[model samples]
Target: MSDYDSGDELLADINAESIVAGTKRDRSESAREVQLSKRPKVEDADFGSTGSNSNDEFVEHIAKTTLKENFGFDQFRHEQFSAIKSILRGENALVVFPTGAGKSLCYQIPAVAFEKIDAAKNGRPHLGSGITIVVSPLIALMKDQVDALLRRGIAAACIDSSKTYEQQQLTTAAIREGRLRLLYCAPERLNNEGFVESMKHVPGGIRLVAVDEAHCISEWGHSFRPDYLKVARFIQEIKAERVICLTATATPRVADDVARAFEIDKSNVFRTSPYRPNLRLLAESVSTKQDKFPKLFKFLREHPGSTLVYVTLQKQAEQLADDLKDEGFHVAAFHAGLKTELKAQIQDDFMASRIPIVVATIAFGMGIDKADIRNILHFDLSGTIEEYSQQIGRAGRDGKPGHCMFYICPEDFYLRENFARGDLPSRQSLRRLLEDLFHRDAVHTPEGDVIKLNQTTLGRTYDIRASPLAILLATLELRFGLIRAITPEYSSYQFEAMYNYYRVVKDDKSQEGKAIFSNAKKAQKWHHIDVNAAARSTGLLRADVIRKLNDYNDRGIILLKASGVENRYKILKELPSTPQEMDAITDKLYAEMETREEDALRRTQEVADLITGDACFALALAQHFGMGLPDGKTKCGHCTHCLTGARVVLPPRPAPSVDMVGIQKILDVCHVRDDPRFLARIAFGIKSPRVFELKLHTKKVLASLEDHDFSSLLREFTKACEAANFGAGTS
Candidate 1:
């Protein structure tokens, strides 16, 4: 061989050796391109920079230029400019701003700014090459954002179940080819392996990961979804370049949770005021369900404009929409059960002012961007203040005067409680099911025949039910290797043998008895092979086979799938006589259920109190979030309570007067001190709950007794009592 040929041969041998050694070359390392050099430094070139110029100055300057050149907006609202600057600096931030406060712009502008910076440094800017992944909880919101961006001539796309398989593949290709800049996806999609892999291959990598509705990540947050727990791991896996968590409602606790989830500095968190002065909060007590409709109708008739009527159930939403339509009102019903196309049409109609009133369930409003809504009416009591606030926040987005009214009936509390209970499974049922799944096994005969060995029948199985059994199947999928579970999708699974014995036996059939012998052997072979395959596929160990089989039967898998076969034997993994551990598990399950119930109840009460309280609406809301009011007073004078004389105050009062007749009348009629204060305190002069609790007919008599202001009513009442010869200790 020539010298050149020998050198080529040696190189080829080395490559072959590396391949055979199972050491695969890292694709990422191999694909690395030459890093571009930094731009040349300008010599005393201000670039329009001033003495006060900062990194943020460049960021803001770039953002403003992009806004005017791209989106055609002249200014940033509230903290939009600062937030975008923070994000561009690669600092994690939690932005708590009201709806329509331009939260999306915070992330969108920074993404554009970063892309521009890359362009200014290099000769060419790769549009949509800089990845900005937005993780939104609402599918509707994702669609809305994608559509809005596309309208702005921006390359944006969202991947959700609504897309067809071909469309998904096309979008995935678009992302890989760097044809899409902003990618919006639901949290569930983040867990998808293919989607994650596609993101890794995208050019420029993900520069920013923005989580919308970030409060959902916290257990203390009102709208807690268990799936949000996976977000941290997802960020870590993708090597999140930067994270920005945005929420309209977050208590200090929820803010902390968001910080922890995003690994953001707590000091970097920015929160806008939750209080909206334009929103007029009102609450009315309804004696019964019959009273709610009239009150709602009255409110609608009084203040008519684009409105959202939130109900708890689909049926209620539909029924109420019908009732409102009957009242000559334009209305549309929206719920999750409705067709997606229809729901979208309804939402479009509502947004376009084609439908003035959209009666909807909670599912409809998560991502709704209707800014002209003048009223938000709650058909029934909401489960929590967080939900109430979110629903009410839909209105007054345009800074116009809006009204929010709640018609509360005490019975609604029970209905909400029942709904919460329905989510939890009974401990006894779960324990029994777990006990069956944990202990099971199988044995095979020498002739490739299988003998059923378990409490469950080899041939009989049960049907799947929609109850605690679904939860059990989910637990099993996570713990054992029986099935794979996907949330908000397929909640259950079916057991099917992976291998086919018929194909194996088909080849051997020719060697069996030619006629009669062949037929008998085939029959025996079928029985043995079928049983053995079932046994092997179950993955149950030999000792616990019987119990698992029993569980399968109890769950109705055997009876439902494998009918007409019953041969089964018991195989215990270990002596199943540990009642103590079983009891502990049961206790734990019960405690969890109880905790959920308690949280639900507490949430209900808090919402109810907020609606009924006499304190300023803004202050009450701020206090709930652990924010103190500017002034120490309980009343803000800006809310309905302060505007009306119903606000309670402890002003200076006059000395006691001697009026026996009025004192006797007040004591005889009033039960609560506030009740008499409302009557005699304003007249005879008293300030107490008893006075208000009782409806004393002493307005005329008490007024005749004293001309003191309402503030001095209590002192006047005390003098009247003394004049009536009642002891100082007596009422």
Candidate 2:
């Protein structure tokens, strides 16, 4: 959610415009420029006919020729050509191609082809030529895509928080000079008015908009994101010529939601068959938790290649990864709970093939285009069939035979059920949140009229996590327009000197500006200055500081850049008055919660049936994705069902025998929470709050069990906690 790009709306250096703009001409002079002509670059590419019309044919020919020339790809598969053809004709398309079926090429080819058009029309690869904007969900994905594009000589750039302020400025400067034919950015950037304005200002114009993982736009999508909902508005704002949305998995309902949100008609929604020839889908039954690990270890040892092991819980991913690593496998865990740097390192390692195995929660696999992955195993149950399909799609992407298997135990469904039902806020939580916001008004923005509230404060007051908070904010934004906008904080500011150092420092004429600008010349080479630090030291309002700098920027006094965390919405309406009005709002909120819970249940049941059913695995899975089985084909020859010639039966798990000594140790040493499970989780290092509500650095505890072996104690404590809360269930 934090990966949005509006932060790059300003210069990187205090005087970066001069530095960057100064160096732009020489690079152009030193490079060999592409030949420009009014005529299209490739006469061979101007095909008069194919499937649609002259332009489609021409784009198709151009795609084939370019594919061969640049990527040595003499062929286009699935709907790749059709997708490219549609984009070239300025048509909106929804492409649901499988993971390795060249889905990216549908947009990538057009971007490259358009680059040639830009080169032909503008004398270089930029200016007057339209830019293709790619809205990707992940920064890593953005970086990978841009890096690949650059390898092929495509003028690609990405803007995200991952880059330094200086680096972001360089990318923007490159875009300004027509160097960026394809600009990749995260979805959150659309919420930034400044970034939107910059896109509108691009001289080459925004010709095409490509959304990867477009399924996120669907309200009921498995991976639905509030930030994604902003993309439709962004596209509308940009007035992009052609919009293409791509995803590997989209159920009919999801596809419909995507179409409506993106305004893509059903006619242009292109779905390649979800069927893959080289992948053999399989499911194995593990009767008990004990049976699962030994079987997995055996599988890994026998068949070794790049593998992805999916687990339901973050703890499972970490524990399994640790276990596998101890067994001499180069494996690491990936989950949302880990710090960002660690996550990045694990992902990078997996991508570089430095780690042959990665045990991950659902967060790791999306947007990964590794071609040689040999296997994907579901160590835990997937929450939905769509997600399950997407996870397995990661394997066998290179058109080589690969294995896709899921280890199923009947008990898994209960955990998934808890997860789905738990995600939405409870009735009490909803009531509390609504009451808090209604009672507390907002502060006026820097503009002094638009009211705003910090989201972090609301989360703290309500005790809601960020994900649920985003969902709540989005719901309010849609129903009542109450949230106004959500954005990052304004962390830093960039400024250029309005007047020369001597004029400002040596004279009384600019004395008023001297406090903020007094040290401007000493830091002239650095593009960014510490806005918060400046405010702390000079007793200036951050808002006032930014406003003054923006004033300087507007009047050519100085160049200013202010980066916001996210853009929240303006509260267009007042809070409901009276108990009855509040009841009405809460009723609506409760209904939404019920709906999500029901949907979650339905999705979980669907996946469970797919896992436990006796039907042909491939047909059942494909049918869910809206693909029709051939009339004579009732079963896929390669699924776990067909290969094993039987339905998998879950082995009944035996409850672990509680270690009374371990439980007593926890009771003895750990601070007891109202809920004993919290104490157990904390002792086990399983992401629980610190004991006694004391700061971690305090090193104070109700009791100490430092002498205990963590592994034995954790195992026993976990089982005891589960036994205590078997009715409540753990996700």
Candidate 3:
């Protein structure tokens, strides 16, 4: 044993110990990851595939295997593995990732993972899912995903209004038969009676509900969908064990809103870093409209290979496409205003490389998964950083370098602000809606205070669009609990007579049935028998009548279809008794509308700042999404601002001044909404539910302050209140 040999031997032993210690540390880290990933199920059920286990390794193993076998991916990317594992463990997961970060794989892979596991154990794909139901807003997006899923040899389907009833029926059957690993439906599907019934019959069960574009559920989200509000209720109805919410673009507030709405554990809410290194951000200053057109043409000529030219309006898109076409580019226009077939064709052509450039509005790229987009050019401001993120995200998705450029001009604010303001109804519209729908008994009711609305008629009246009116009505329902239950089935029936309904009334064998039929047929059509009316006349219990109707329909005694069904609204809560009470409720809602508009405006201002600020455009935009720039990486060298060392110093915002007498007159005109903030909104001509009802927007009586900027008015009023040191907070 020489000294040199002993030293070498000791060093070898030390290195071996270090290796073992490191492996143990790695194992401990993996265990910690599993422990923190626990998202408890909303209820207990046989997950069938994700057996009861505490091993994170099992979930991770399944995720990797599913990814490779089903999605044909060698490994999970970013948060996909964690999200999928959380879902399979019956834990609620809310995941916010940037677009093209493979958010879809989080749910889609899990859908197949569950099915494969269950099938492997049972030796067959049986009737089961407690299945994965993906609630998406766009039919085209659903179709695209389903098409992709089918291509990957996964069982996936979607039920939407775009399909014929028969086609929807077939799709629904597939869902119920437990053959589908994933099913996509619009949020409106929750309101659909037939679809709801079919979902209830899912043999595998609706164990997991994945809400795509989860940001839509938040009123404060950049894009709010009224239908998204009903999703939580639908999930409750199905008693789903787990929920996984995926959104490509969500701010901190929007992410919090989604997690709270879905009852997902706050700790379980995972967000991928918003920073995308592959994208090169650029901002082009357009001092005039003229500068933008020539610059846009030059950029289009330079950047080729799947370019997206985003404009503010459909007309602008069409004009841009036309001009680009004349400039020798293969360009086509895409906007929601285009027919569905045309939009689909354009999307297809764009994906297949047929269309080199697409001139589109804000509606073009949501849920679109084309990978090779080389450039995205914003012809106008997108009104918000969220909008900008979502739009620019369409480019550089393929892990390839991509360019995103925005042409900024101060003059574009008018159109953008107008678009944001249009979403809010003037206070007058709200008052008229309240008067017609609630207070005045405008709903055609047979008896009692139950408000029965012919939806089409009420919706079309007073020049109110149906969608906006529905949102208002929904707001009333949610805020005040005014609308109790809304059933689209106006009629319920029980019939099983082989002979004519009139003759069936005399059958001794079917005496009670005959009596039921006799009473049901009186004044009411056989197919549209009002359950209450029939049960009352026949002296049978309402519950029994409903049961028999179900039996009869099942037995094919009489072919029952949902052809003439109309919506029936039950009023559980009484209307505001007096005009004063109604006014108060209207005023509160008006404040909400103002907040929504302000949200839009604030987001637009952020985008403006992003373009004009001297800071790295990527860093400014990334931090807007709550992700900090890495240390020592203060400047993103890829941005146009950083590259060119260009900066724009914006002029100081104008100071707001308020006229006390003008404010007092406005308060006198609107006694219900006395909050200084609410008053300020009105002073700036922001729409209000009650003030508009009072016709306060007219030329006289406090309407003269409309010329003031909304933000300034709000700031001045807030300051005035502080100066006076009274009426500080409404609450």
Candidate 4:
């Protein structure tokens, strides 16, 4: 049986009380214990024995000791203790705590405990000679956590794109030498064959796996990352003993999805209420875009500590920060578009309290742990309730009074809805994608027929954004069971000889090895090879060429790196034959996309309802996460709804009319792309990949009608396309 089997007998055992010698219990409890004690005790060789209640005290003691010794904590909170105990007991868990609720300790403490226990048992400080792997999406967060752990005399290291190749090699050596108790990496690193192979050689194998921000694995989550879907396969491949999934903003649906993905039992799911009484939730109405500044200026003058003002667009962040600076406020704009060095400096300044106010998009607050942020002002509506909850949760983390204000306007809502609608690809594009994939060459493998896909090329050809394209492929795999995802492969590898190239080539005399080394083109000092090209030229199989390259890297003869990653999938079923059959599949996939789009728009509407409704604000937010305030209290008593008993009503603006003359001029000048959606995007000022590719952002006529409603502009562009006798297309 699998480790996570949830049968009736296991359920009975879980509910039974502990059996101790020389102890008395109630009749019912004694009967339950006797029944459970009759079952065979299965001892696990790698992990501790299952259902070993005798070790509970030891686990609790070690957890507390580690907490105090390594992290300087006197105790673990109830949620943290339960999750940590389960992990030490070799059980899977899903931990959902509010932001700033010490979720990191839940996993970090257990990682330390694993090492401490192993050291005591075998005179070595590692988990059965293996390391705990932490899958975190934030590179900065990984570095920060690793640094903090190292400061506390714990062995921890992170491997990410920010690290140099030499640094990564050093980390690899640490892993092999059993020096690292914990390893942190991004979700996409699971696709790195070299890293995975290195991990496979660990003495015992991977110990415990913790997936932070695990909600990204759920499609229902607000920030779904397709790479997270591969984590389950990664666990299976590595034969990990236990898994723990952690997140701060997962809804109940997302929580269930994550738990099922990791095989976490329902009883092992842990959560803490998101209600923080110290935060005062408030909202106000804005009549026009220009009317917001006066209110914002007034609020900033009143609340002066470190503040975060969130905007919807990157340009909006810059403009708002500039306007605030004009008012003599020390402020800076933070967004993904900023230079890396500048962003790092800005973050440092903010953390050090040098920048009192930061105007930023949603990208600013992922790993930020500032404790004294006094105010969080939303200059625009958040994308979802989860997003709002997370952003506001960043405030008042120190338990002092923090004020959160939302500026509500009809324009922001309309824009968010349009963005959700704009994300869906056209049906024609989906059909084209299906036809292209179904016609691709299939390689017969033992499991099934595998097809390789260049995601970049496919996305560009079909006008699908990367996220939507990922969702489409995932729908095919999970929803329809048409394909099973496999490890993606890089098209080529670039390597430089470790020492003298001539000496190394002369030493390797095998036919495939000589062909690979000699045929590889030399540019400067590095030799680059396209494995497929070399295979065809030498009449050798591609697998043989790659194996030789990997062998060279393994033997330290070459420093190798791979690039141009292509996704691979094994087909599970036959392809559709008739056009009608193809259309059926395409329409189902398109409907899946539509469902997600509608879900996003619904979340936007929920945020609007939260602001405009009369319910207690904090209670409403908690209820959204399938919880209530502590002590069964329904009202927070400190929110705007509780204090004022007034709802914020944002008056709607009049519908915008189309400008025929401006539209004609745009059509006349912007002839680079005939797709109606592309024209609509230009008119609505939504920048897409094709817009930059066509250099349309520089056109003065583009976005001339950006002030108008996006839906109205899209309709106008579609009519224009039809009138011009060209059928409708998409971008």
TM-scores, one per candidate: 0.65, 0.75, 0.72, 0.81
- Model 3 alpha-carbon drift over 4 Å, by segment: 1-54, 119-127, 197-201, 440-468, 484-568, 630-632, 649-731
Q: In candidate 2, what are the lDDT values of residues 438-550, reduced to their tens digit?
A: 76655565523343455655655544456667777777776576654533456556665556534633553432354466534346443466655666567765544554455
Error of 4 at 244 (Å): 1.3
Decoy 4 TM-score against native: 0.81
Clashes of 3: 12
After the best TM-score superposition of candidate 2, give how far the Cα of residue 477 lies from its true spot, in angstroms.
Answer: 1.7
Least well predicted 10-residue stretch by lDDT in candidate 2? 29-38
Candidates by TM-score, descending order = 4, 2, 3, 1
Which regions in candidate 1 have their CA more than 4 angstroms from the true location? 1-26, 29-53, 123-129, 433-590, 628-638, 647-731
lDDT of 3: 0.68
Q: What RMSD does model 1 have?
A: 18.7
The lDDT values for all models are 0.59, 0.68, 0.68, 0.78
- For candidate 1, the lDDT comes to 0.59
Q: Model 4, 593-706: lDDT tens per residue?
A: 889988988889999999888799999899988899999997899888898977777797677678888888889888733467778777777666666777887989766877
Better of 2 and 4 by TM-score: 4
